[model samples]
Target: MTLRRRATGLALAIATGTTLALTGCDAAKDAASDVIASATAAVASAAQEKMNEIKDGVDAAADVKAGRTSVDGDRTVAEITATNPKDKTADYTVMVNFRDGDGNLLDAVVLNIDGVEPGTSKSGTARSNRTLTGDTTAEIAQALRH
Candidate 1:
């Protein structure tokens, strides 16, 4: 038996006032046993809704790791991790868009990661075009293979 844990805070989940922790086999079984009946239904429904909204009828070929945005001195930086699941090497261009509390686009930037090998993951960062105020949300505008 092996156990691995990587914990990171996600802005979207935090914004939604929810926290989801999925652990390895043993811990997963323990978590399953601890959840209340009604809460399970609520979590499933909420997850499905969020998936549909994010996918927008498009299939997700790749996965974006839990991302976080933070104020970096004079600029806001968005960091994202991506996993590529193919044999050949590929380049990914990820657009990280910054939005205001009202869902208005504030500033955006593209994070380019080159030469991602098969079945491997990498981290990339993008800086906001301009300073943003108030509640800022960072989302993956696009994750395309080239």
Candidate 2:
């Protein structure tokens, strides 16, 4: 083969190899993105199911309140207070919700405070189910006394 023709062939081979390599990289990136999206959707679905399982008690939400939320080691936490107004001791189940500054729900947790004396207030801490970022606030979503 002529030397000039050999050089042209080698250049063409390198260009083809480079193009194949770039296409492979793009395909790998797309596959990774799809896996990540699937995992995120699964997590969100599980969290929603957990939130839906909670049922509110009659006229008991007014007895529970959530305090300020703060970050603790990548998790959001808040103080929960439950006031027992019944003549007898009561057990309380409280659902606390964590939200961002834009009012988007980040996490929700159920806390149980048992054997609270009548006319007394009991306090507990509610922690997020997963790591949360940015500004977070907490609110009492539901409360039940039994």
Candidate 3:
């Protein structure tokens, strides 16, 4: 091949490699939508775990739930539902967050539940430290069935 042709090919390969490397770094962090989706799934899984705990085994499980967020004066309140799916009582830790229209987190709080009876659903609320305005969103950050 000509010397000029070889030089051009090497430059193109280097440029392609550089672009791929940069793109990988740019997408290093999770996107807002991806975070939201994962959080939603986790919250739903917690709820289902509680609901199905009452069943004889883990193989028997059903149900899904969503969290709620509302503005109450100077405090933003977030509520997430958890269930005791087992035949016995249980406890769970739930984390809730308040966000604005742009998906910016305004506040977050952790909630706890004790003595949740079998086959029952209980709601836990987290109040933000500061007030929120404009469009607000509430999501469950984490829920652990204990």
Candidate 4:
């Protein structure tokens, strides 16, 4: 072939190769961007789920603290009779007994009273301030009423 024709053909081939290389580089960049976008979306979804779980846990704890259980029970009132006095404080033991309708002993609860005076007949009333899991509190209240 003539030298000028051969040189022209070579230049055309080189230009085509450069164009293909540039297109391949653009495709790679686009693929990488797509992958990054998908990864970012997945991470955001996981974070939202974790936040929802944390909110649910906080709500459950608040319900328990408010004493909003479904347990059936009644309040029992008891009197504090004696106590042991200490420096600016005292402790007293109060007994609470529970029984069924047929007079069968079910349970007993002993609670310590703090800041009570020794040798004093302190006539204070006690009651279950929160809901219980069983009828023990109800039975104790019935026995005290009698």
- List TM-scores for all candidates, in order: 0.55, 0.63, 0.52, 0.27
Better by lDDT, candidate 4 or 1:
1
Candidate with better TM-score, 2 vs 4? 2
Error of 3 at 62 (Å): 9.8
Q: What digit string (tens of lDDT, one per residue) describes model 1 on residues 1-146?
A: 10000001122322222222344466654444343223323333333333334332233235664366788876778777878777777776665667778886555455667787889988787675445567787887666665
Ranking by TM-score: 2, 1, 3, 4
Higher TM-score: candidate 1 or 4?
Answer: 1
lDDT (Cα atoms) of all candidates against the true structure? 0.55, 0.68, 0.55, 0.34
For model 4, residues 1-113, the per-residue Cα lDDT tens digits are: 33233334434443454455556688755655454334333333432332333321211111111112123245434443433332333433333343335554333333334
Q: Clashes per prediction?
A: 0, 0, 6, 0
List the candidate 4 regions with Cα displacement exceeding 4 Å: 1-73, 83-89, 123-146
Q: List the residue pairs that clash in candidate 4.
A: none
Per-residue lDDT of model 3, residues 87-131, tens digit only: 887766655556778887644555666667899987767665444
C-alpha RMSD for every candidate:
15.6, 17.8, 16.1, 32.1
TM-score of 4: 0.27
Q: What's the residue-level lDDT of 48 in candidate 2?
A: 41
lDDT leader: 2
* Residue 1 of model 3, lDDT score: 39
Better of 2 and 4 by lDDT: 2
